[model samples]
Target chain A: MARLKIESLRKSFAATTAVDDFSLDVGDGELVCLLGPSGSGKSTILRMIGGFEQPTSGMIRIDGQDVTRLSPERRPTGMVFQSHALWSHMNVFNNIAFGLKLRSLSRGEIQRKVDQALELVGLAGYGHRQTFQLSGGQQQRVALARSLVLEPKILLLDEPFASLDQHLRERLREEVRDIQQRLGITTLFVTHGQDEALAMADRIVVLRNGQCEQVDAPDVLYRNPQTEFVAGFIGQMNFLSANVEGGRFRHPDFTLDVEVQDGPAVLALRPEALRLEPSDSPDAAGVTRATDFGSHIMVDVELRDGARLKVMTAPDARWQKGQTVRLAASAFALYRQNRLLARGGLPVETVEGRSRHALA
Target chain B: MIRSYSSTSGRFDWMGLAFAILLVIVIAVPLLVVFTWAFTEVWRYPSVIPQKFGLRFWDQTLSRADVWEALFISLRLSATVTALSALICLPAAYAFARMKFPGRDLFFLSFLASHAFPKFGLLVAIAAIFLQLNLIATFWGVVLIQLVGTLMLMIWIPVAAFQAVDRRMEEAARDVGAGPLRVFWSITLPQAGPTIFAAVLLTFVSTFYETEGAWLIGAPQIRTMPVLMINFINNQVVVQYGAVLSVILWVPSFIALIFARRVIGTGSFAKGFGA
Candidate 1:
């Protein structure tokens, strides 16, 4: 295994930059995911590291050796492309053994390694089958086996499961993760699916507009996003525009104590972090809609000031539509100009008394 | 049920029958006349068929030394011209198909322009240049002139073939430790093999039958079969000699057509041109 370090890497096509000043450090045997939507430069970064694309600036070092100027064949990196580009002229065995044959390995050795790689991808006796004879999922397995047989120091996957069905994508991602952990090869996976990144990557790098938005572990990224884009992109977040003065967040319906300057701020709260209770006070919000998700009910509440919020609560008849419900946030993040300023919990104050709702 | 299906499907097709008759009158009648003349000892005007049928002329023409020399020269020139065209044009076709250099489209258009005009006029101009360069009446002169005809077939068809090769497959080969040359051999060439083979066969057959260039450049010394056939038609009194030469010249192209059918079925041949 090798540790890959990319320092200030940048790529530009004639008039536009695809990736800009992107730097990443992946430890030995760690699978780091570059997660973003389309045109986010995630795939460009992976291609630069795989030597398929030359960076306009900066350096790529693998195990303390500079490899920025190396061609794809000279680099110790193998990539599984998005289209599973197996050669149609070759059968499964030849497709996987092509690189080994180029290295001039003996026939017996190449056969043994190809068989072993096929078995590792769960296709033990499919060597003689033609590549076109395989299904979409099976073709991807052959593509994976083709790259893995080279025994490269680094493995790169560019949305390899983007063409498969939902179940197949899930099963293949799990299998790929299992094989990567078993082989302990340093891998960089590029995906637009957040769930895939969360399930397969040791750490996720969220990118936006050719720049790094946030990089953190899965649960940490979901629970504590550092920016408003990350907060909204990672999960379902309710954003409310409010004003802050004298350390008090002044919403149209209610107010809360905050630790920011005297200016307008944005509050981002996750659906499950807010609590709902039936009430008749002027500060209460009317239930617009409610959906029961078997384990919990997702209630959409619209405040009197025309602001809407989604609150997740247990199965309660009082959380239905037309019910005036008082809202309380167990946790919230305050943002100014799309940057997170502070995060805290708020207590719900009712006619009876002030009570803090602790959510699991 | 099978009998009824056949009867309905095979109902009399007058259009197809008319086309078949037209084809026979246009193509088969001349061939029938040639074959009959090659075997006839005597045939005269005002008669539908030959008065006497024999192989006397065939025996006489087969014994001629010029016939054998012309056949050998035709085969040798076709082979050399085909090989040289492939050597020079395949790489240029690939560069035109895949590379992004300045004036590439203009260069490609120029290759297409080789076939745009009356070829005899062009050959006369080229002959003037060949005469000045001491290339007149030389074997290499005929080869050079024949190479011009092969350009359109050699460059255009294979350019389309190479353009149709999936670039992702080449990148996959490179990603798996194959260098640029290795990727081309393993992936790109094999995918484009059938179409390129079809182009080579076309170049060979066309060069074999090429008359103007061989007649103008290799006269009096290096005579190909088509050049000899033209000479026999112009100078010889007997008709059987030209008939035998025509029959002999049709053999290579007929065989080449059969081979072309197998290499690229009619569908893909059309697709190669479509691109």
Candidate 2:
């Protein structure tokens, strides 16, 4: 049985719908990420699960118990806020011990639990330090420890690393994932950052306009996004308008044979899926604007018709500015409007032999 | 270079020094005169200073049965008013700071409007209402009137203080299994400590110095220190006794100001509300 099940949850504030028809089931010990840009209702879903918000029309079941109308304090979920929300007046030890104390645990048990939580978050001896005296990363750990000490039925983190610097954020992302896995706690993490979601989550739920756009594993979300929005959002993609007639796909600069239905479609090409080679043909002429980032190079090509295509290549690859280059895709996803048509590695003959033959 | 330029300019600010000294003296001279008269045995208008100084007036005022009775009544009334206003305002302030209800801004503006209205103008109408309610000359009557007059400060200060408390802190507490009241006591109240302390001090001192409501609402049957002080001033022969009463009233307020100085100096209160 699913540890937590949310069915058709909707929340409307005044005339605006903040979260609409949201539904998901979190399995036992699964860490799911709600990923979206700002104002996408991901945080709203987390708040609803945490019982901070009341869904307009839906039911939430945790461990087979209805919890939709329950107040936050009555629920069995723990949440770490984006601000880390450490009690400024309380020391780290007291902040971590707060939930245990509320549960009316024995003094000795509370102490043991708090100490274990501190160790789990790697802040074992810093319990007595004032929360404000700690650095941003330490404060975030205290927030995590505070929630984890409760041994709640579920853990909800609302962009917990948003306040930290990039370096600290990356480190804590791994630490939190490790801790969550060790405890095997059912967890829901909310973040607008795609990298954070991809790095930490076992599954990603993409939200847009108060609804779930797609829910899949990180690799699946990146490789085979079912929608154009998901394709663009999860990773970088170059969208090119093309037409398929009798299994031949034709674009302004290139043509190839593909097993696609005869119609107009948009091809979503990942930058890494394409390559650039110097060309003398006027039709294949393009200028190279390459940006080197040590590990890889991102080359942006401006075609003669004013279309910009990006291609990612190895750091050793060299291309001069204003050089004419032909573009070829090793793989791409085809979409008709917002609907997906085909996706995968292109046939070698279709990419090289057919393109060269068509150009000649 | 800028530091040297500022330092060089700072040396010739004689006019600024003069204005500060004048400001202090202007404020201190009245209290000094009141203190001097409270202990003066004999003085004439043309003397410019007292010819004789003793504690005769102070002793006479302290020995009076009515004077001590008035002092006790005044202390009790102010204390009750301060407590009652806090009980009413703390929740109202929290609501104004944290919750969004219909007409919230209008409700808050009403408090500001009540504070802006001159207290003296409302005294007569308030007295009439108290008289009809059979609350005239009652201790509770004076307490009620003082609560109304001083509630604006009690509420406004804490509203800002509570707003300064991050909303996420309260939510964190709730997520940690704390109920609403527990979250308030453990998080909200402690975060708002300095402001609440300042509010109590302001409310207590204001109520302690209130004369209009005390005199108008609790005159003969309930004689507060201010009412007695007014009585002493009304009598030409015993006019100096008013100075003794003024010193008596000033003592608690002075102590409160000293305490407030420490709290406000912590710099938390100076950040202002909604900061």
lDDT per residue, candidate 1, A1-360, as tens digits? 799999999999999888989999999999999999999999999988888899999999999999999998889999999999999999999999999998999999999999999999999999999999999999999999999999999999999999999999999999999999999999999999999999999999999989999999999999999999999889789988878988977776556677779999988889888777778665567899999988888888887778888888887544667888777777888898879999876653222133223233
- Model 2 misses residue A194 by how many Å? 1.0
Report lDDT (CA) for all predictions.
0.89, 0.86
Q: Which 10 successive residues of model 2 chain A have the least lDDT summed?
A: A348-357
Best by DockQ: 2
Please estimate how well model 1 matches the true structure, expressed as its whole-model Cα lDDT.
0.89
Candidate 2 docks with a DockQ of: 0.78
Worst 10 residues of 2 chain B by lDDT: B1-10
lDDT per residue as tens, model 2, B46-75: 999899989888888899999989888888
Question: For model 2, how does the per-residue alpha-carbon lDDT over A302-354 read when each residue is reduced to its tens digit?
Answer: 86557788889899999888887777777778888788988767621122223
C-alpha DockQ of every model = 0.65, 0.78
